[model samples]
Target: MSGSTATTTPQTTIRIPAPAVTALRDALLRPDGRERVAFGYCSRSGNDLLLTEVEQVPDENHRHSSPGSCRPTTACEREFISRCTSRDLHPVFFHSHPFTDTAWFSTLDRQLIDRFRKWLTTLYPDRDLLFGVLGHEEMRIERVTADDSRPVAVDIKGEWELEQPVRPTHTAAPDAPAVDTERFDRHLRAFGEAGQTKLANTHVAVVGCGGIGSILAQTLARLGIGKLTLIDPDEIEVSNLPRLPGCTHGDVGQLKVSAMHQRCWEANPDCDIISIARPVQETEDYLKNADIIVAGVDRVTARYWVNQFAVRHLIPYVDAGTVIETSDADPPQIESMEVYIQTIVPGVTACFDCLDRGDPDQAYRESLDSAEEKAAVERGYIDADIEPEPAVIDLNQLAAAHTVSAVKRLALGTQPPVAFRKYDDVSGDQALLETHPNASCPTCLGNSLALGDSTISSAADQEIATAPLDDAALANPLEQTDRTTRDWFPPAVTAFFASDLAQHPTTDP
Candidate 1:
């Protein structure tokens, strides 16, 4: 697994978490050589296709393999199938090209898939075995059928509790470029095929769904960025409607990502959008494949994390926000209004954190984590929340538009480095930051390690997802996972919880 790089999958994608793949790699790449494992978890999402959760089964004894081949021993096979029967999961066969960088279903592999698929599908005919091949530098996964193998593009999601994302997974065929030149006729005239293909193939990670974020998402969707990974933890509140598109009065209390997802799909149905209703800290893996990360978040701590990740992974990052300060001296006049957009390219430009390194005020504000700061307050460290800045849709839109323009130009290879920019509302002045990277700066200097070489430990630990023991789940390629966790829940289960709560109202008799 490596850092984020945007990619597209046709119809099927098997997503494994970074840690599971790391663990699997550690096991398979032991000083001893080639191995096979009844390794992962299996859960079905939609009726025919969606796989909401596919994890590495976390059992140690459930594997066997010999040196040049990955076929499981007869005893391990039967034991794995029996375990899957008990666990109630579908299984996928997982292995690797140990001796080489390129791996595929050799005649032996196809035979193994055929035999293993028959062994289980004979009992549960509706199930088929999905096989995956991991190589030294790349990986591929496919759904195997009786006569043909359909490549199930491999993806990795979860809180990336490791140095980088799971290794990049390559599929056989990516989607054809959008041929509706008539739709983008005007844009075609402006940027041409090189620009068109770049936009079509690029993935942008949107890190918020607030005023600026919402606008950015909608605008980018309309512009046809091929894939979008939208991350935000807030739900739609009544106040959000005034500033965010795709947010209605009816959307109140629903996840912001939900609204963004619906809006993105509506704008461009052909685009692939994955909505993660969580903060960037919890879902950094999504950023692993993102070509550009557009952040519209309000929290400085979260932004700091993004800054660190972007530099560490060598991903381009852009963040922008708007603010209005009002004075209550008699008439409550607007004191100052401003918006800023900052762009950071790992080795090319100054890092966002550099701005805070010299100033105590800025550094303090950047260091504050609302939740952690709240805890600190209880321990008597801080006195107040960050001052609330009024937001206007107009201001938000302006900031988003400028950032979007910068992105479009950058993608088309025409924009210069504008590390930071400020627009003054009162004076109607635009300012560009001209600071150079500090020679000793951590993000872009000589000491800054290249992508994936940073020895920093993870911000969080990988929580093992618990699933029941199923024969099919045991036979899968990756690992087992249940969607019914405190942080993540399937829609059906969410609805059930709501209904259950309503029915079991606490009555004081």
Candidate 2:
């Protein structure tokens, strides 16, 4: 994946879909005591490197293999590269060392990487390369640039656990003191210091600082979440005072996120809160870094956009909403009151599109320019006056509570990562429904899944495409380096494996 490399030290994080993780383990970690190779395709979005698909090399096609040496047939390597270039995706090379539990690149591994890097640069000068060494217990990834290869964070997007030994180079703020407060004594007692620490290290983005969102922000703060980002564009109204937290008649015209920020600080003064008083679309850079996203917006259009964003970036998203339907009779009477919470674990769970819950028409109308929207309204494509939806604080609270519970489960790994629950006030019962993602979902499957920043058109893409190449690695990403004394295997073996394959002509998949 090649893009505009950050002038600042780039902190790269790798996100692999759950199924791709399974495929890698099953294909490369065979019971037989021998090394194996595989390849995957990925995209670079901002600081994230997302893997979308994985392909294993069949044993019959290997040119050579042993406990410490492995190499795919020349055809296999060429085919993999072809597929990646054809799809505008980057190739991620993987090799497993079943002999050990710890993973690190060997001298031979570096040699092979450099050869491929030099070869690929000749084919596509601006392209980037990624190489990984997989061990039984841990994995190591190297981000190949024109100048040097550095370690990057490799995190699985779903429930399956993978240990990443190398940490990315991202500066973190000072440790939060919220978890050590006397106010969270009971909370610490419930989950222990380690759990509290996990919450403290987490950063959550709560979109839509309205009834449910305000409650979520305050509750997350009180629960010791170290960082909170409150996002919304609306201002408080007289009608919103009852449902909004820390709001009064005097603050009726202020931005909802500002009031929610104050409310969260009062709940836990040590918690860091950022108020983004703008539409969610304009805040992708902030949202991409969040460990979790909580969507509390009222419209399906907004929810749909959030879901799409979450799926593309492989961010966990929790969606919460409340519905209060009333009869349009002489004297309106309540028909139903319901609270719903859906937890989306990117590749692991069903998305808004899979659930068929998003209104494409409404989303389209919202995406239109003001004049276009007016034309649409005049054309009878949408309602000229959309009546305000009925909302009650009690129901919003119930939704917020459930949504927070889902967030807790995700943060603590206390349960399955996926959930869809509903509470019906009239029926006096709650139901937990199973979610199944559509096989053909455009948002969370195939080419779009885990595409990262490249999935959306942006100025960065143009910058990367036209940026001047400043280093030879930009022309040839991997570097050929000297051998080390700590070779796990003989140098002769590594040399044969690295040079023998490149001699053959390239072939297509």
The candidate maximizing lDDT is 2
Q: What is the per-residue lDDT of model 1 for residues 113-156, given as tens digits with 9 covering 90 to 100?
A: 77766666567665546777666655566676665676666644
- Name the lDDT value of residue 334 in candidate 1: 84
How many clashes would you count in candidate 2? 3
Judged by whole-model lDDT over C-alpha atoms, candidate 2 comes out at 0.77
Q: After superposition, how far is residue 295 of candidate 2 from its true place, in Å?
A: 0.8
lDDT (Cα, 0-100) at 370 in candidate 2: 88
- The regions of model 1 sitting more than 4 angstroms off are 1-176, 357-380, 384-387, 446-449, 453-509
Q: Note the Cα lDDT for every prediction shown.
A: 0.65, 0.77
Candidate 2 residue lDDT tens string, 60-162: 8789878998999999888888777655678888888888776778889989988877788677764568888777765667767666787666666554333
Q: What residue pairs are clashing in model 2?
A: 45-453, 146-473, 146-474
